[model samples]
Target: VNYILIDKFQEKFGSAIQNLSESSVISLELNGINISRFGKLCWLQVSTKETVYLFDILTLGYEAFDFGLRRILENEAILKVVHDCRFLSDCLYHQYKTSLANVFDTQIADVIVRKEEAGGKWPDKLRLLPECLSHHLGLPAAAFQKYSVSRQPLEQASATVWTMRPSHSALLHLAARHMPELLALRTVLLDKLMVPFTIHVGHSLDAYR
Candidate 1:
């Protein structure tokens, strides 16, 4: 299988009507944009003819997956957008989980919290941030804990995770390597809005629509 990896790219198009003018490869007719942020929407589309997927680093979710996997799952030409990217990634993780297969900072934070759960070189600014709220309210890391945890640089983990299941392992490492080490633990959604919800709460990602 061709393991395509794209980094720092977007798949945005103004509208189906507008994109139609570009190339048959480019179009705006999408199945639907499930969850989105920052003015970008994440959509999932499929065709019986083929399946397409895109691994652009900027946007690596359903849109790219649908487009890149087109040949495997469908034959119908895909209609994709290319605005900011990542719009779909935010939601796709929640929607597809395993099918979409991705990880991010929120996820790692949640994991470590269950263990250390708090305070390790976090930034003062993040302390009040809505996303990191829960983190602070909860017990800081582990006081009398026996296990060991270390907060490091994200760049450092990026190189290591690749050797062991790059995708999942890398993201796991990334979460631990957070910049401030800990987000202020602002909001409860840190778990809801992050990988935990996507990995545990969401439905079978294999059945992603």
Candidate 2:
């Protein structure tokens, strides 16, 4: 099946994908817009829960983030296996596969990602994670949120920026699923090398509840 990726803000802005004359080649114009993977990632980290809840209420007369519910599940079968809102909402509404299969994220606590990039300079530590939150919220290198972003209304802008941003992998993969370089990279970084990498995993709903 030909998968037509409908990328908007992050990439593939407006109208036609030209340059196929007797050849099945998709060539972008000289000024082709690359999707804002950074921005989308920011949004996902921020907007997803709200967006997914909107999806749940779709039958109650609300608009969903376009095509979001499809991302939640390719089919309903996956839904029956899990009941957590984060798992279901992230997978279907936002296209995340959160199986934690053969994963060591639960096991690692000592590893740390030192964020030394000059732009968002903060001493590298495990606590202030996922970059956007660390920098925007002025998280100390070793600081935890200390409070939830959603709990406080004042930090909502910061929340919105980081949460909705999509990863570069998703955008690139959408362009070409078989893109060897990225797949290899993801396999290594995401599926391998035992992470807690540079990102912090938040508490589970059970813990919070």
Candidate 3:
């Protein structure tokens, strides 16, 4: 994963946007405190098949979205894969006035697939990302435990952990590592949606928008 800060943003933005534009699909994950209109968005991770770029949102501020990121997000032609898009959509629309389009939300998709597997009965509750990863992608508990350990320090520190300047390396790694799994989970869920019995459930995934 390449960590792009404000100092190198201008030099990298052009090529980054170009690569993103050419890709048919990309994976995204946002890290922050609270992550709503009222909260802070610290990092924006974008992953294509070839690379993962972690943009420092806290340092770049509005400039991060203003340059070209916002346009790519709003582009309906390219599909953006995310775990759960509610808070992400809320944050982007309210804070940046950016409407997320053509999203393939894995959380919603997971619920749909699970419901079908359970004989059309809805799940008792929404599954978290780690749970979804384990259920669909067979991610081991040890792996989840490792990630949890990496995230625990910052989370325990305070809500302001995301706001700290010169973010901890563990935090950055946590942010970057999520993209590949997220993308992989999307592929697995999509394949499950392809069965004839689940065709309607697949169509229902668009309800996320």
Candidate 4:
């Protein structure tokens, strides 16, 4: 689960993500800070079952809205696996007026699987990314908890600090593991699912329809 850093987004990200579209399936993880109700998409992490690519979206600026990136997102041929893509999808639509296609949200799918396992009864509780991974993939809770810590207290600084930090920095190390962990989780969870999954029509919570 080694990662590649795409610091020069305008020059390399478009081509990098475009080439990713050639794969049959892509697992994507995005992290951003909320700025005035809109997501300031700062980082985009992608994995193709083999390699992980981390893009510093802040480096791209408006150029992050490149047509190549849009094509990959909107392409029905490439299945995109994500967890809780609602806000991420909204942010993309806000930035470029485009929506994601061929998406399978693991969070939504987990709900459906859990419900099926409960024999149509409501599960007592539903879990978020960390808990879900711990249950299905045996990921250590401590590893996930470390992601919440920042070497520098980001609460007092701009969210752009995530992008400015070096790869060796504590924050970057924790944040970058998201995509690799997600890629592994997808395979493990799908095998343990008790029910068939339905592709969600949009960024809605209820995927049962």
Candidate 5:
């Protein structure tokens, strides 16, 4: 995992953005106080299969997006796997004037999977990231203890904790952990979706025969 602050702005972050642009698919996670249109968006975690980058929105500000990140996020050719993009989308569009494109939202996918499993009834409630991780990845609680523990302290702390400069290790750890799990969850959900999709297509083909 790499932390991209003002010191590493030009070289490190620029290279990361370039690499993200080149990749066909990547996972994204955003952290902030509230993370809605009116709230602060402090850190952005972008991950490929190999590397994770934590971009410090507090330190680098809009330059972080303008430098190259915006292009990648808006680029339709690049697929971004994220969990529940509503708030992320709101924050980006309202604050940064950036519209996300080609996004695969895992939360929505999970809902669709559940709806299919229930014979087309929509789920009553949306699943959070941990639940999605457990349900899709088949990971036990012990497997994700580190991630859970890392997030709990922040949840109890003040919202301004995200806006704090020189972020704490716990916050950084939480940011670093989400992308890999999200990428894994995407793989599992995609596989699950295909089973139903394939069956539906096969039935449609039978109608022609």
Candidate 6:
């Protein structure tokens, strides 16, 4: 998988995303560092059918929220697929006051397709990302563990890690692996869901309609 770092974001953003047309679909994976204490988002990983783009938000800071990036996320024509996008949603709104326009959160779709229990409670088995990926796509448990190892260090690392180039390369590799599996998982989940899943009126994602 190809990777793009923040130092090159401005120069490469145009060319990297130029192929994203009106009908293109992109899978997204977002990771943040020190969320409760500082709420700093560290990485933004996006993947099309052919490529992966890793944007280091912590490195870019407020510039990461520039109009071009905003336009892509806000674009109604390009479908953004995220796993459980709660943290990503919170960061987007907190940083940019932007509500995602066209999004499909796979966790919400799974809940809807699995159906409510007799008492109208959602079943919990298929909720988490690793579980869904493993069950639906047969990804090994070790893969998730390795991803966690590669990511947890970056997530919990000191703020200086973002400024250091060598510290982030492996993290980018792990982050890049996420979107491809997500696309595969989405296909399997959609097949199981067998219908379109709709987001309710509230900003929070839920399984309704």
Best-performing candidate as measured by lDDT: 5
lDDT of 1 by residue, 1-209 (tens): 11122333334322221232333333111212223432222222311112222233234445543444333222234323221224344444344431222123343444455443243443333222123433444544452121122212221342332223234633433222222222223134354446544665456765665
- Ranked by TM-score, the better of candidates 1 and 3 is 3
**Model 2 lDDT per residue over 1-209, tens place:** 12233334222212111111111211110001111222222122101111111111112111223333222223322211111123223333333332212111211211212232233355444431223233333445443333233213323443332233242344322222212221122233333334333233434434657
Show how many residue pairs clash in every candidate, following the order shown.
42, 29, 0, 0, 0, 0
Residue 121: error of model 3 in Å? 0.3
Best by TM-score: 5
The 10 consecutive residues of candidate 3 with the worst lDDT sum are 1-10
Cα lDDT listed for each candidate: 0.31, 0.25, 0.82, 0.69, 0.84, 0.69
TM-score of 1: 0.21
- Model 4 lDDT tens row, 22-64: 8888887666665222657777777776777777777766565
Cα TM-score per model: 0.21, 0.20, 0.87, 0.77, 0.90, 0.77
Which regions in candidate 5 have their CA more than 4 angstroms from the true location?
Answer: 1-7, 146-157, 204-209
Write one digit per residue (lDDT tens) for candidate 5, span 1-209. 45443325767877888889899989998888888798888888889988888888878888877888899999999999998899899999999888999999999999999999999999999998888998888889876787676665654465678788777776787678768778889999999989887999999999989
Off by over 4 Å in 4: 9-15, 35-37, 148-160, 163-168, 194-209
TM-score-wise, the better of 1 and 6 is: 6
Residues 122-180 of candidate 3 have per-residue lDDT tens digits of 99999878888888899898867755665656444555777877777876777787687
CA displacement after TM-score superposition, residue 186 of candidate 6 (Å): 1.3
Task: Name the lDDT value of residue 75 in candidate 4.
Answer: 84
Arrange candidates, best lDDT first: 5, 3, 6, 4, 1, 2
RMSD of 1: 17.1
